[model samples]
Target: MTLQANAGQLLVHRVASEVAKDCFALATTFRGPGAYARGDQLVRAALSICSNIAEACGRGTIPEFRQFLRYARGSAHELRAQVRIAREYDPARALHCRTLESRTTLVIKLLTRLHDRPPPDR
Candidate 1:
């Protein structure tokens, strides 16, 4: 392992970076008209997915990271729900949100696996 490198950190860092960048794109592309207020919900939830993972990975112990991963997972699920809302309430943004939601789900899957794996002993 290289300096400042570990399985958890590597996974969390990459996932977080992706989430951040993706959310930025989503925000930029968001349309103004919305009756369901899905735009704000999606932006927040998508951002949370990465931030929580990064925060959890930097925690003091594995159990703590697990707690954070749980948060990240919840955020991922919320992001999916928010995106789906676009389909029902804001049809125009639905596809774009779907793409972001799908990516968020993949990140969630990866994080869940990382959370389940045994932590390396330092």
Candidate 2:
């Protein structure tokens, strides 16, 4: 498949993508069946941030987009908490959590900016 520049140009997209990648890496660190559920939750939350942003953009309305951005931001916050819990459960993954936290922060800040601003003219 081909990649496009338009979507990549958004700061939210870039940051969210990074967070998702980090989360995927962290998920693989999960050991045993008991830890699988927790890892799955972290993966879902990370992916939700990326999916919500894209879904928001697809809604074709500024208000809808802003609303979705808020959803994405909420997901980011959730991921942050999940990361902290993961760190507590497994200290070895603390570094991964730190990186994910930083990327998630960037996504939240960009989403806040998009939500507050008027839609750009087509």
Show how many residue pairs clash in every candidate, following the order shown: 0, 0
Q: Which lDDT tens digits does candidate 2 get at residues 17-103?
A: 888888888988888657888888999998898888888767777777778888998998999899888888888878877777777
Alpha carbon lDDT at 96, candidate 2: 73
TM-score of each: 0.73, 0.87
Q: What TM-score quantifies how close candidate 2 is to the native fold? A: 0.87
For candidate 1, the 10 contiguous residues with the lowest summed lDDT are: 1-10
Give the distance in Å from residue 101's predicted Cα in candidate 1 to where it truly belongs. Answer: 2.2
Model 2 Cα RMSD, 1 decimal: 4.5
User: What's the true lDDT of residue 56 in model 2?
Assistant: 77
Q: After superposition, how far is residue 96 of candidate 2 from its true place, in Å?
A: 2.0
Candidate 2: lDDT over CA atoms?
0.80
